[model samples]
Target chain A: MPGPTALNFSEATSHDMFAQRLPQSKDDSLPQVLAAAVTHLHALIRELRPTQADWRKVIEFLTDVGHASDERRQEWVLLSDLLGASALVEEINSRRPKTATPNTVRGPFFRADVPQLPLGGNISLDGIGETLDVFGRVQDLDGDPIANAEIITWQANAQGFYENQQPDLQPEFNLRGCFRTDTDGRFHYRTIKPCGYGVPDDGPVGKLLRQAGYPLCRPAHLHFMIKAPEFETVTTHIYDGSDPHLAEDAIFAVKPELVRTFEQQGKGWLLKLTFIMVRARRGAGT
Target chain B: MPGPTALNFSEATSHDMFAQRLPQSKDDSLPQVLAAAVTHLHALIRELRPTQADWRKVIEFLTDVGHASDERRQEWVLLSDLLGASALVEEINSRRPKTATPNTVRGPFFRADVPQLPLGGNISLDGIGETLDVFGRVQDLDGDPIANAEIITWQANAQGFYENQQPDLQPEFNLRGCFRTDTDGRFHYRTIKPCGYGVPDDGPVGKLLRQAGYPLCRPAHLHFMIKAPEFETVTTHIYDGSDPHLAEDAIFAVKPELVRTFEQQGKGWLLKLTFIMVRARRGAGT
Candidate 1:
C-alpha cells in the first residue's frame, strides 16, 4: 500500500523501483491471490528477457495453441506437453510410493472410449509398413497378473503424425489398436514401427516454441491412458529407442528407463514391453 | 521430470490426485512453466469453492473487461489495479523510495503528453459542483523548490467520469489539468469534489472481482505525476480522507499520510498540500 505525501520538494532524485515478486502474505481472497500470481508468473517470464520480436512470436504461437483445438483433438495439450507443463503436473501429483508407476501427459491424440479387443487380436488398419509385433503384459505392483486387463493403444503412421492429426499423410485409423491382456496378463499388437515426426507448428504453440528456440518435433511414441476399475488411471507414452529426440523430446516425455529397442526376428521386428498398475483396495473409490 | 510408468499406487491408496499446487516437471521451458501456473492458479481459484452461477457471471464480466478496451482505455489495467497488481509492481520496482512519498499505481486513465500550464493557474473547467480551491506547494526532499516542475493531473469529474472516458457526461478537458510548480514550489487548482465510484463490472476483470467477493469502487482521489529537471518523477494518487474505499482503493494507492480532510473556507473549501521530489543526478536516466 502507498502512503500519502505532503513533502513539497522540487529537485528530482534517482530511484530504482522494481521488485519482481510480492512478499509472502496471508491469503486475503482468491482473486487477489490469483492476480498476484499472474503478476508473479508474468514477471518470471519477463526475466527470461526474450527479445521484443521473440515476445511477439510467442504471443502468435499461443494464439495458435488455442486455434489448434477441436472437438476430437487439442493441440494445446501437445503444446503444454512440449513445454513440459503436463509432465510437471504429473510429477508434482505423483506422491505415491516410488515403486508405483509414474504418470505422463495424456498426449493430444486420444479418444474418450477405445474399443476393447481380446488378446491376440490385431488392430492395424491395413497392416502397412514393415511387419512389427508389439507384446506387453499388465501386472499388479506385486507382480501378480491383472488377468484380462485392458490395454488401449494408438500411434501415428510410419510418418509420425497421429491418425487424427494427419489423415492425409497416413490412412485414417492406421496403426491405431486396442487389446486386452490374456489370463497370463499379456497383450500384443501387429503394426509398423512409428517414425519420429513434427507436431503442428503452424499454430500458436509452435510459434511460441520456435521463438523460444525450442523444437516442434517429438520422438516416435505410443499413447496410453490406462484405466481399470479400482486402480488409478495412468497417462503415459512409450518412446522408440532410436528416435533423434531421444535426448531432447519437445514434450519431455522420454525417460531412459522407458526407452525400448526393436529386436530383429525373422523378416520383421519384435518389441517386448510390460506395464504395472496399482491395484485398488476394497471399498476404495473406483 | 516425469518418469516411466505413472501407476504410483502406494500413494494413491491414501490421497486423491486433486490436492494442491502440483507442478508438472518434465519440461523446463517457459510455456510449460506457464501451463502449470495456469493449472495451479485455476485450482486455487476452484478451492475457493465459488458457485457455478457465480463462475458464469465472472466469465461474462471478464469478457466485458476485454470488450471495454478500445481506442483510449485499457480495461485490463483497471482489472489489474483492482486485483492489486499495479500497486504490487510499484512496490517491487520502488528504488530507494522514501517513506513519506511512497509509490502507487498509475491508474488506467493517464495520457502521454499533457498541456503545460503556468504556475498558480487553475486548470479546472467544470465550475459546477462544490467550489473547492486546491492549493499545493511542491518542494524537494530537502524542502527547497528547484522550480519549473511539471505537475500533470487528471480525475473523474463530479459525476465520477474522466473527460476521456465519458465525453457526454463530462465537458471536454473537464477536471483535467497540468500545471508547473513555481520557484517557491507552489501550485493551485479549483474543482469539485470527485466522487468515489465502482468500476465497470461487465468486463472480464470486473467479473473476476465480483466472483472473488472483492469491492469494485476506488476511493476519491486526485492523480498527480510530477517531474522536474534534476528531480525524479513520481506518479501517485492523493486519496480523500472521507472516501468509503479509502482503506481498500481498488488499486491499493491509499496511503495514510497522503489522505487529507476538507473544510469550507469563505466561498470555497481550501486545500493546502505539498509534494517533495528527489533530485535527478548526472547520468540518471529520467
Candidate 2:
C-alpha cells in the first residue's frame, strides 16, 4: 500500500494535521471526543510552550498518578475532582430545572451493597461523634411525593476518614446505608455528624495540589444517590453549612442550594431537608 | 480559620471559581500553567459535554495508560507522541534558524553506554541484512567543520526489531553506536538498512490506536543525537526516503529535510549526508 502523503509539521499545522489524520472510528463520538481532546491538548502545549524538561515532568507526574491508582484508589478520579472537571461535567450533563437538586461528584467511596434500613435507622455503626438526625422528603417538581425512592448514602466519620479508608478501625459500611422513602415521601435516618475531610493527599494529585498551594480538604457533606423508577437518579451531596471548608471545598462541589444548616436539637444536631428530583422523560434511560 | 468565600458553581462559573481558589504557589509558573490547564480543560469539557459515562471512560483510559507504563515501557510517552503533543513541544522549544537541522523526538530506546567507535567501524553486531555505508560531515551553520562532534546513533535491524526488544534474538547494542568526527569533521560507519517497525501495540496506547484505526507503524529511520561543546545538541532521526511508512510515521516525526535515499554502490547501499549544527549562545547551556 502507498504511504500517506508526506506533509511537513510545524506548530501551526501539527494540531490540524493530527486531527485530519484520525481515522473514522465505528463509534462516532469516539472520533469527536478524540478530536476535541487533541485540539485542547495542543492548545495547552502551545500556551505553555513548556521546555522539554517541563514536558518530561508532566509525563512523570502522569506516570506517578497511574502508579498510585488501583482497585482501592482512583487517583485519576481524584485528579478530575480536584481540577473541577468532574463537577463541570456533572453540571453540563445534569442540567435541570431550578427545583431539582443539583448533582455533584459521587466521590470515590460509594459502596453498592449497603444493607437496606428502615425509617430512623442509624447508618453509623461505630456511634462515634455527636449524634445527628437526618429527616428528608423526596418529591417531584410539582410537590408530589415520590414514594419508595431509594436513598443510598455514605459519609466520612467524625475524624474525616471513611470506613473503607479505615477498615481496621471502622466497621464495614459504617456511616453508610440505604434508606427507602415512605408513602408520604419522608425518609429519616440517624447518624453522627461528619467532619470536613482531606482527600488522599499522599498521591501525586495531592502533591500537585500542595505544590500549587491549593487546599486538600473537602467540606463536610453527606453523599446521597436517590433513585425512583420515573425520576432521574440524582447523585449529589448535602454540605454542612457551618463547616469551615464549605467555601473552599477542594472539589468545587458546593452549591448554595445543596448547603443546609444543622440545627441544634436537644444534645444532638438535626438536619431537615427536601430532595427535589426531575422526572425522566419517556423512553429516557437513567 | 475563616473559610474562603462561598461561591456557587455553574457551567459558566465553575472554571473561574476553580482558578480563583487556587492559592498562590511559591513558584509563579506553577499557578500560571495550572490556570492555563484549567482554562483549556474546562473548555474541552464544555465542548464535548461528555456524559458521565463518557467521562468515566476517559478516566479509565488514563488509568490504563498509567498502568501500562513502567521501567520497560512508557505508555504515557507513547500517548503523548501519538497525539502529536511531543512533536509540537519539540518544535516550540527547539525553534532554531532555518539553516540548522531540525530537532525531532529522541524516542525511548537511546542509551548512554554505547562505547565510542573509530571512524568506519561497523555498528551491526549481528552481521544481518543488506550491508550499507553511511558517511556524514558535521558542520556549523556557516558551513565550517565541527571536529570531534559526537554522533550517537541507534536503529532497528532489517527485520524491524531493536536489540532491546528481542534481547534473546539480537545481540546487545546491535545496530547501535557512538561515532566522533575526525579533525576534518568527517565520520562514517557501516550498518544494515533499517526497516519500518510497529510501536509496542500491545499496550493501552496501541489499543487506542487500533480502536481509532491509526497506523501503529513508524517509518524506517535511524536515531541520532549529535552533540559538541559550545553548540546546542540536536536529537533527531534520519528517515529512509524509500520507506512507504515515511508519510505515516506513528509519531509524526518525519521532516522532509531529514529524509535521505540510499544509493546503490558496489552491491551495497551508500547514504551520504551533512549534519548542520547551530552554535550555542555565549554562556548558554545545551
Candidate 3:
C-alpha cells in the first residue's frame, strides 16, 4: 500500500492554500490521470520556482498555441511534437516485438477517405518529384502471408506540403492512396520521393521552436495505416535513411527501424520493404 | 564538473529514438526551465503510459480552453487557478514580514481604469444588495501610517457577477473604485456586501470542475491593489470570515491574515481591515 501523503504542498503552510479546494467527498470521479497531472504540475512549480511573470509567460504561450490551431493546422500537435510529448506518448504505447513493425505518429494530416487503387498504381496525381516505386509485403510475425491486407499511404509532396495544405495548387488526394495486398501479400505504389520540409512556422509553435533553437524541418517520410482481417490496425511511417534531417526531425517521429533506404534505380528511386502484423486478441476486430 | 547524463530513455532503444533530435547547437537558447518541463513531461508519459486516444483528449481540452477565452474572460487563468498553479505562483513570490499583508492572485477581472472616488464614496452604482461600509488603513511594516497611498478595488456585485461580465445588466463600473489614503492612512467606502459566487461555469474550466467534483464557488472577497510611494505594490484579496466558502475558496486566495469579520452596524455590515506595506528596495518602484 502507498504511504500516507499530505494533501497539499509539502512545505510552508500558506502555500498549499488551494488544498481546501480538493473534493469534499472521497467518491469524486476525478480520474487518477487528472490527479497525477496535478501532482506533476505541482512538482514542476516547486522545482522550477517560477515567478509571477514567468508563470504568466507560460500561460500566454499556451493560449496562443490554442488560438493558433484550426481544422487545417494543428498547432497543439506541433507544440506537443516540439516538446517531445508526442514522441514520448508513442514510445509508451508502442512497445513492439523485434519481429513486428514499429508504430509511429499518425500525424495530423491523415485522412480516412483516401482513394483505393490497383496493384502498382501511381498515387502522385501531381507528379512533382522524382518518380519512385514503393513495393512492400505484408506478413504475420511468423512469416505467414496476410493477403488482402488494406494498406493506406500518404506523404507530403517533394516541397514538403501535404495536399490539403495547398488545396488550390495541388490536385485532390495528390499523394494519398489505399491499396490491397495481392494474393502473395505484396503491394506496390508509384509516387514522387517525399522531401524534408518544415512544419507550419507561422504560429506559436514556431515561436517555441525558434526559442528552443530547433528548426522546423521534419525528415522526409511516408505515412501508412495497415489493417488485416485478424490483426490490429497500425499507424506508422517509413523515413528516408539518407535524409540529413532524419537525425533532427522536428517532430521526433523518426525511429531507426522505420528508416529505409531508397535504392538508386536509374534516374528514379525504388523501395522494397516488408511489414509484420501482430494477431489481435479474441473479440478484437480490425 | 558534472557527471554525464544519458540523452534519452534508459530501458529501450526505440523509446529514446528521438534523442537524436536534441538540439545540435551547444549554445542553443533552450532555457533550463523548458528543458526541465520536457523532462517532467517525459516522466509523466512513462508513468501514465497513455494511449493515443488518451493523449488526444488532453490536446482537445486545452484547445477548448483557448477557444473559450476572449477580451472579457480568461479560461487559461481559470485552468491555472483550478489546478492550483496560480496559488502556487503567488505563494512563491509573496514571502513577507509577519506584519505585512499576504499576496493573492490578481484574478482576471481586475481593471486598472476603475473610477477614482473621494473618501466614503459609494461604489455600488447598481444599488442591488445590502449596503455596507468598508474602512481600511494602509501602514508600513513598522505599524506607521502611510498617507496618500492608493487603493484600487473591485469585486463581484451582490448578484455574483462583475460589471464587465454582464455589461448589459449591471451599471458600468458597478463595483469598482480607487481611493487615496488620508493624512492618517485611512480610507472608507460604501458598497453592497459581496456574496460568494461560482466562477464562470459555462466554459471548459467549468467542465473540468464538474468532472473533478468541485463546485465553482469562490469565497466572498474584495480585490485590492495597494500602492504607496517607495513601497512595493501588493495585489491581494480579503475574505469575509463568515462566508461558508471561506474554507473552500475555488482559487485558494484566502490567507489567514486576509480574512476579516464584518461587524453589524445599524441595518448594514461594516468591515475594517489594515493594509500593510513593506518598504520597497531602494531602486524598486511600484
Candidate 4:
C-alpha cells in the first residue's frame, strides 16, 4: 500500500498556489515579467471565461501565425503592428524630449546593404513616379550640424510596392539608398513619391484583421534610419501630410511631427525638412 | 502638389485611437475578447517598457514554439499548461456544483479510439509494474445509480511512457480501455500502477521551464472521461494521494477531492471511488 497523503485542496486558494509555484529564474526580470504575464493572463481568462473550444481556437490561430512566418516574412510582427503593440512599445521606449526627433517602428522592409549615393543622386532608378527632391540636415537639438552622419532611406514606388516585394518588375535598389551628411550636416537625394500600400494580408494576421473589419492600408510614408557616433540612432518615417489614410494608418504609426507637405516645384515636387538628433548619455554604451 | 492635410497627431490619445479603430465583428464576443486582450497586452508593455531587443526575443520564442508544433504534438498547449493557463481556463469554464466531479485539463495524450473492455478486464497488455484494481460507481447527485454510463480511462506504464510515445516497446492500446457501468452503477478495471512522467521536454516550452527552474513532472494520475445522455461530460484525473509530486503537480491539476489512496488487497492493490455527475441544463445543446 502507498503511504498516507494529504488531501487539503481549497478552490479559493488554487490560483494563489499556482502563482506561488511559478518557476524562479536567476535573471530577476524574467521572473517578474513572467509573473506579471501570468497574473494578467489569469485575469483575462477569468473575465472572458472562455470555453474549451474558444481556447482551442486561440491556440490554433497562434500556430497558424507562427507557421506563416519565415526569414523573409514575419506574420507575428504584422500581428503586433495591427494590434498597435509595436507602436505602444515604441512610445514606451522612446520617450524623447520635444526638441529631439521621435522614433518610430523600423518595419520589416529595411535592408542594411543598399548602395551609398552622392548628394543629389537619384535613388529611383526605374523612375516610375513623379520626381521628388528631398533635402534634409542632420543636426543636434541645439541646432548644431552633425557632420558625416549616415542617413539610410527607402520607400515604395508609385504602385505602392517596395523594390524587394517586386523584384522582377522594379530595378535593383529601386528607391533605396544610403547617403552621408556633408561637413555642414546637409544631404539631398532624388526619389519617386511613394503611395499608400496594403500590408501583406494573405496570412493569418490579415485574416484576423479582415474578420475585425479593420483597414489594411498604411498611409504613404518614407522610412529613414539616421545614425552618428555619440548619438542615439533614430529610426523614423516622414509621412506625406496629404495622404488620405493619414488619419487611419493601419499600423497606427502616424505622428504629426513626422508629417510634411510636399510643395510643388516646377512640374515635380520638393520636400525639405531637418532631422534633430539627441546625443547619447555619457558612459551609456549603445 | 498634394492637397493640404490635417496633422493633429496626439500621443496621449494614440492608444485610445488604436483601441477605437480595432476591428468590430458581427460576433460580439470576438470584439470583446480581442479588446480585453489588447488592453492587457498594452498595459503589460507599458509596465515592462521592454526594449526592442526584448520584444524581438518574445516574438522569436513564440515563433519557435509554433514551429515545434505539429499534428502529433502541441507545443503551444504545453506552453499554456506550463504557465497555468489551461488550468485557469478549465476552472473558469467548469464551475459546477460541489457534488459534481470537477474537471481538469484533458491534456494532449487522449486518443478517441481505444477498445472497450468487459468488467474486471485488464487494460495493461504488457502486465508491467504492480497490479492495480480500480472499481468505481457512477451516479447522480440524488445517490441513484447511473446505469450504462460510459467510462473511458488511460494512463502511463511503469516506465512512465504512453504507448503512443513508445510504439515499438508497448502493445497497441496498452493501459487504455473503455467500459460501461452495470445496472448497479459499478465498474471495475485492472491496470498497472502509473508513474509520474515528464512532459515533452525536447521542445521550446521545455526550454522555458528549464530556464525557470520549474519541475517538468506531473503527479501520477489516471485520466477518465465519463458521459451519459442528459448529463455533462467530465474530463478529470484520479491522482495517487501518496505520490511525491501531488503537492506540486507541474500542470497544477490536483484537487483534494480528486486524490485517493491505494489500499493493500492480498497480493495486489485496490482503489475504490465514486463519480458524481451533474445533469445538463435543459435545451443546452451539447
Q: Pick the candidate with the highest DockQ.
A: 2
Q: DockQ of candidates 1 onward, in order?
A: 0.07, 0.54, 0.42, 0.40
Candidate 2, residues B1-286: lDDT per residue as tens digits? 2333456577777778877867655567887788889999999999888889889988999999989888757788889998889999898987688878989987767777888999999999989998889999999988899999999999999988888778899988899999999988999999998889998788888887767766778988889999999989989999888887777777889888788888888877899989899988897657
Question: Roughly what TM-score does model 1 have, to 2 decimal places?
Answer: 0.58
Spell out the clash pairs found in candidate 4: none
TM-score, one value per model: 0.58, 0.90, 0.88, 0.86
- Model 4 chain B scores worst on lDDT over the 10 consecutive residues at B1-10
Give the whole-model CA lDDT for all candidates, comma-separated.
0.61, 0.87, 0.79, 0.83
Give model 2's DockQ, 2 decimals.
0.54
**Which of candidates 2 and 3 is the stronger one according to TM-score?**
2
Candidate number that wins on TM-score, 1 or 3: 3
Off by over 4 Å in 1: A1-85, A95-101, A107-218, A228-230, A247-252, A263-286, B1-85, B96-101, B108-192, B197-217, B227-231, B262-275, B281-285
Worst 10 residues of 1 chain A by lDDT: A9-18
Model 1: how far residue A106 lies from native, Å: 2.8
Report the CAPRI category for model 4: acceptable
Report the lDDT tens digits of candidate 3 across residue range A150-192.
Answer: 9999999989999988899999899999999998899998999
Candidates sorted by TM-score, best first: 2, 3, 4, 1
Chain B alone, candidate 2, TM-score of: 0.92
